[model samples]
Target chain A: MIELIQHLINGFSMGSIYALIALGYTMVFGILQLINFAHGDVYMVGAFTGFYAIHFFKLAEHPSWLSLALTLVVAMIGSGCLGWCIERLAYRPLRKSPRINVLITAVGVSLFLEFAGQLFFGADPKFFPQVLSFEGDWSFNELKINPLQVLIFVVSIFLMLALDWMIYRTRLGRAMRATSFNLEYASLMGIPTDQVISLTFVLGSTLAGAAGVLVGLTYPKIDPLMGVLPGLKAFVAAVLGGIGNVRGAVLGALILGLSEEFLVGYGAPTFRDALAFGLLIMILLFKPTGLLGLKRAEKV
Target chain B: MTPSTKIKLNYQSSILWGIALTLVWISQSAWIGLMNPYYLSIIIYAGINIILAVSLNLVNGFTGQFSMGHAGFMSVGGYFSAYITTHYFAQSLDSLSQIQQALIFLGSLLAGGCAAALVGYCVGLPSLRLKGDYLAIVTLGFGEIIRVVVLNLDSVGGARGLPNIPGLCSFGWVYTWVLICTFVIWRIIRSSYGREFLAVREDEIAAEAMGVNTTQVKVKAFVIGAFFAGVAGGLFAHTLRYLNPQTFDFNRSVEIIIMVVLGGMGSITGSILAAIFLTTLRELLRPLQEWTQIDFRMVIYSLLLILMMLLRPQGLMGTREITSFFRNRRGDPR
Candidate 1:
């Protein structure tokens, strides 16, 4: 029972990272109906940014929670700027083009960013210098739980609540909802729709950046292509939960993370990829609109 | 008409085919002579890739079904062909006289093509139901699943890759398979079935309303496309006389997709031309050796795909044939 609990906790930590990334994918897809394939690369850049801030800037080592807080705000904002710039420059002009063209461009942007990172940082995996290391283990019956897992859980819950509040309560959130509901209608209503789109990207990417840094701290290794698989899995999660739906994204991420764990437990570790992709296929065939996403049928 | 006229037409037709074949043959042998068999081997593999890319383009470009599983069919063909050639005539091939060896080699090639064709039909049966991005993801998953399953199965020497399977191919065999696949694909493109596939690309509902059985048409193209991909795999396996699971990754499938996309997707000659160009370009670019200190292929591919999408959007040749130049100058078909 304890081992099961421990595994569940581990899965939850991984799932939260996926959930954070899925939110970015779902949110952009919600408003624009574009699958931003580069969203994963955005997550990657966040981790790299945070890594450099600590490693190159010589931030204090394992600082108290307060000092660590400053680093996150800076990292999140940096990531937000990057996402905002990408959307404006690479994506905005192609908005009127065919979906396939946009999709191909998204893939191109993803490669460009990843290769850029590789060129700048070199191809070798590097450690994300740790700060606020908590070395403690908790045992309940027989399950060994780490302090890091608890931190992951608490931080994710707080962020999720904050995001929920933002989406449901804030003025920008209302603008976002109205835009997604009907872009032209919202534009007529005098909403600064373009700004909202850019802000939506910033908000989503900020969360992703935080998630990337936290996950990097836990995993302790970072590489350029690291985001590709995780990004793909998260996209599946968004679809599974229903893209354009926030809570659905979270629920889908948890399910995917657990299923991945289960596959690791029983199947060849290599087969986890097949398992996740297989689920994407099965879910699409059964529920094309996704579990949480409300279907908006196109006019013939 | 006199018998001489009939003989002249046959002679002209055979001459055209012969000239084409000899050109490819002489060029390949020239490659073999200029560099060791190592470079020759690379060129042969590149031709095999052209076969895979051109076939895949029919399903992806003409039909508008995004399938990233080219490597799956290739592996299926690879393993099957290897099993037949090695399992059946290993000792006979090893101990036989020259003429017997030659006959067995011919049998193996036919066996490989047939096996690949059979699997194509089986796989294509399911493709009838899938469309768009949904089809792509499924195909991608199918490719990965095949790789894992092959790695696990020990009979075909799974993870280690089958090596020492008898290098039985020459320049003749390689070019011959390429010729057969190219001809078959080109014929399909000019047939009534080609119209149906194009219709599916234009609009599925319109095609359905127009009494075209969209599902059956799609399956036919998918099956034939998979068959050639398989044949390419067979040729590849024979050329290398080796097989490994790693050789057919999602990346390899993506690479072929790139070739088709880089070449005008619907233009058969364009895909063939692009395949040869990109394959050679990639090899040639690998020699930068820290001078420019860049992997130029990725940047070239990224820029080309992005630029084509942003500007041309429909690749260089689009659906127009290369011969359309002369044909257009002469007159319209009507």
Candidate 2:
């Protein structure tokens, strides 16, 4: 029973990271209906940015909450700018083209980021600096929890709540919602669809950047190719939660994270990677609309 | 214009095939001996890639199904055929005559293709019910699942990869399969069945409304495409004399998809040309990569893909054949 609880805590922390990334995927997909394949690489870039920020600010030496907050802010801003640029440069021109063309271009952009990242950052893995040492653990009887896990959970939940508030309470969020509902109608109704779409990318990328830093703090190993599997899995999570649905993405990610933790804890470790895809196929087969997705009839 | 003219065209086509076969025979028997091994190997690899790209085009280009799992099918064919040759024929290869050895290799290729086609049937039957990006994701998932499963199988060398397979593949073998794949797909594209594929691509609901059995047509395309991909994988395994699970990953699938897209999705000749061009380009970049100490080839390739989509989404041939240019100039109706 303790072990199960321990696994649940581990899964929750991991799932929170997935939720951060999935929110970005779900939001971009919501507004543009294009899978921003480069979003994963953007997360990678964010991690790298955080790494550089840590070094530049001497956060490893200082180790303060202020430095950590500064690193997160820098990473988020850097990734947000990249997301905006990706939208403007790679995707905007292809807006009038076929969805397949956009998809292919997105893939092209993804590959470009990965390979170029290798060229720029070098192919070797970099050890992320520990900005804050969450050395001790909180123990309750046989159950133990790492302070880092609690920090990750708190930060992610806070970000998600902020996002929810932004989307539901703000005028920009209203514009975003309107744009996603109908681009042409939204434009006609005086919403700046292009800006709204770009902002969605920015917002999503910012969260992914935060996730990247949190992951760096937790794992300490950062590499260019690290984003590929997590990106794909988070995309699956978004799909499972019902893509384009924000709450669904979070729910889906948490489910995926918990299941993966249980699978790794109790089942064969080699099949961990396959479990995400298997769950995807199963969910898609049984509930194409996803867990919280609405069923819409196809119009000819 | 007349029955006699149609007959004359058929005669000309047959003559062209005969000339091509004669050239292939000559190249296989003698010309290969004269060529440098470096260039010879590149040519062989190009031929194998041509087979992959053309077969993939049948489904992605003509049928308009965005399958991103071609590499999974290739890996299945490769591992299965490699298993047959290594376990069954490795011990007796020296005892067998030339004819017997060739026959065994041919049999393995067929077996590999059949295996892939069967797997394709299973994957396609259920997945084909979905459309567009949903279908793409499902296929990608299946492909990843196949790779993961294969990685865990100890008999196939698992993650270490299956090694020491016979190098039975040659230029002649690869080009022959390439020719067969292209010819078969071309015939399908020109037939009434081809129209159904195009109909499904143009609009699935409209095709279904017209009683076009869209699902069946899709499954057929998927199976046929998988068969050719399998054959290509067999050829790949034999040529390399080794099979690694990593060789048939998502990147490899993307490479083949790039060929089909750049070649002009539905254009067979374009696929052939693009395959050769991309393969040769990669080989050509080796020296540059050595000098620069950076892998710029993939970077260039990805950039090219992006630019191509932006500039000419229709691709090089844009669903038209190279021969169509000549036919159109002569005012011959296709």
Question: Which numbered prediction scores highest in lDDT against the true structure?
Answer: 2
Clashing residue pairs found in predicted model 2: none
In lDDT terms, how accurate is model 1? Answer: 0.78
Report how far residue B131 has shifted in candidate 1, in Å: 3.6
lDDT of 2 by residue, A196-266 (tens): 88899999989999999999998889988888888888999999999889888899999999999999999
Please report, as a value between 0 and 1, the fraction of native contacts recovered by candidate 1: 0.41
DockQ for model 2 equals 0.72
TM-scores of the candidates are 0.89, 0.97
What local distance difference test score does each model get?
Answer: 0.78, 0.88
Give the runs in model 1 whose Cα sits over 4 Å from its true position.
Answer: A297-300, B1-19, B22-39, B86-92, B97-130, B289-294
What is the clash count of model 1?
1
